[model samples]
Target: TQLLEQSPQFLSIQEGENLTVYCNSSSVFSSLQWYRQEPGEGPVLLVTVVTGGEVKKLKRLTFQFGDARKDSSLHITAAQPGDTGLYLCAGLPSGAGSYQLTFGKGTKLSVIP
Candidate 1:
């Protein structure tokens, strides 16, 4: 099974801060997806980088795929209270039609206002 793990598991900071979250694995994936979710809502796709070494940015958020497609990272610059949410990365392994994502436990970000 393809596995993805996240570091820190949780983060807390005052408004107007900076932070980075990481996702790593020992296996290569066909595609990688980054999503941010509010407590009761489904994850919203931030970006999907299919090729290795791909980098995409959304507003103050940046997403990168590892050279070997075995890892990814999400960085939020100058985080705001609105950035508070659960951040997750989903890696699609080979032979997956519906590659149900193996999700990282989650990085619960709390931006204190």
Candidate 2:
């Protein structure tokens, strides 16, 4: 079984602050994805990283995949209150043969204005 562990399960910061969260796993993955979710809504896909050391940026958010494909990170720059939500990291293990995604516990972010 593949499992992902996310650090600092919850985060609270003021608007304009920057934060970085991590997702780690013992298993190697073929691809990893990040998502953001709001109250009463399903998670929205933010970015997908397939190559090792690949980085993708969306406005103030940045996503990076580790060189070994066993970890990933999300960094937010100058976060806003509107950025407050649940952030999730999911991975597709290599040769899983199924479409099931292994997800981290998730990080709940609260940006106070």
Candidate 3:
């Protein structure tokens, strides 16, 4: 079974600051996805990386897939209070046929205004 691990299980920062969070796995993935969830709400898909070494940007946030497709990172610049939430990383194993995904323990971020 493939497992994804995220670092710094929780974080607190002030608005306007920048932070980076990481997701890693021992196995290669066919694709990796990042999601953000707010209290009492389902996680919202932020981005998906399919190609190794690919980088995607969403407003103030940037997502990058490692060259080996075994790791990824999310970077937020000039964070705002609205950015406070739980960040989750999920991955589809390279040869998996089903839609099953391996998820990492989420990182909860609190942005102080």
Candidate 4:
């Protein structure tokens, strides 16, 4: 099974709307990082929550960490075209054996003007 999964692979909405994206997994991680990427550019870090049941807010975006550290969610209030991008969640692995990350396929959000 995929360590992590994201729902609503694609989303399109008008300006000033609201939407939510979900991420799920069966494994645990030391931390989870959310990223946003614009066309032709690498993803930029949006937020990172390291604790179970953690919640962090950035502007109109709200991020939450699952109690088991195996799930997550992103809620966008008042969407705008400028908010269009790819939303990705990556796990920060720790301890022995590689410590590589597991990244969600990504949620493509398009907020039209």
Candidate 5:
């Protein structure tokens, strides 16, 4: 079974601070997606990275894919309390043939005011 490993499973930072979360795997994937989830609601898709070494920016957030397609990272600049939530990374394995996503354990972030 393919697995995604997320680092710093939990994070707490003051408002206006910056933070970064990472997702890694031993297996290669065809595509990878990042999502942000709030309590009592479904996850919201943030960005999807398919090409290796690709970088995408969504306002203060940045997403990057490793050259081998085996890892990804999310960087937040000047975080706010509104940014506090659960962050997840989902990947589609190259030969899975299925549209199902393999999700990482997730990183819980808290931005204090």
Candidate 6:
């Protein structure tokens, strides 16, 4: 089984500030997805990275997959209070098909206005 470690279990910042969260593992993955979860709700998909060294941008948010596909990062520029949530990273292991996933504990972010 692959294990993913997420850094900075909690983060608090003022609105308009920037922050980056990370997910790392020793095992390679076929794809990685980032999600945001609000209180009392399931996580919502933010982005997915499939290729090594690939980067995707969603509005002011950027997502990147490491060259080895064993790590990923999510960066938010000019963070807003609406961005406050638990950010999770999940990976689909190679040859594991689409049913199983290894997930990180998640980074909880709080953006204060």
* lDDT for each candidate structure: 0.89, 0.95, 0.95, 0.90, 0.96, 0.96
Clashes of each: 0, 0, 0, 0, 0, 0
- lDDT, candidate 4, equals 0.90
The 10 consecutive residues of candidate 1 with the worst lDDT sum are 94-103
Write model 1 residue lDDT over 48-92, tens digit each, in one string: 989899999999999999999999999899899999999989888
Model 6: how large is the Cα RMSD against the reference?
A: 1.0
Give me the displacement of residue 5 in model 5, in angstroms.
0.5
Regions of model 5 farther than 4 Å from truth: none
Candidate 6 per-residue lDDT over residues 1-113, each given as its tens digit: 88999988999999999999999999999999999999999999999999999999999999999999999999999999999999999999987355688899999999999
Error of 5 at 102 (Å): 0.2
Assess candidate 3 and give its TM-score to the true structure. 0.97
- Model 4 TM-score? 0.93
Error of 4 at 48 (Å): 0.5
What are the per-residue Cα lDDT tens digits for candidate 2 across 2-56?
A: 9999987999999999999999999999999999999999999999999999999
True-structure Cα RMSD, model 1: 1.4
Clashing pairs in 1: none
Superposition TM-score, candidate 6 onto the true structure:
0.96
> Tens digits of per-residue lDDT for model 3 on 55-96?
999999999999999999999999999999999999999883
The sequence of per-residue lDDT tens digits that candidate 4 reaches over residues 51-87 is 9999999999999999988889999999988999999
Q: Rank the candidates by lDDT, best first.
A: 6, 5, 3, 2, 4, 1
Candidate 3 CA-lDDT value: 0.95
lDDT score at residue 17, model 1, on the 0-100 scale: 84
* Over 4 Å off, model 3: 96-98
Model 2 TM-score is 0.97
What shift in Å separates residue 68 of candidate 1 from its native position after superposition? 0.6
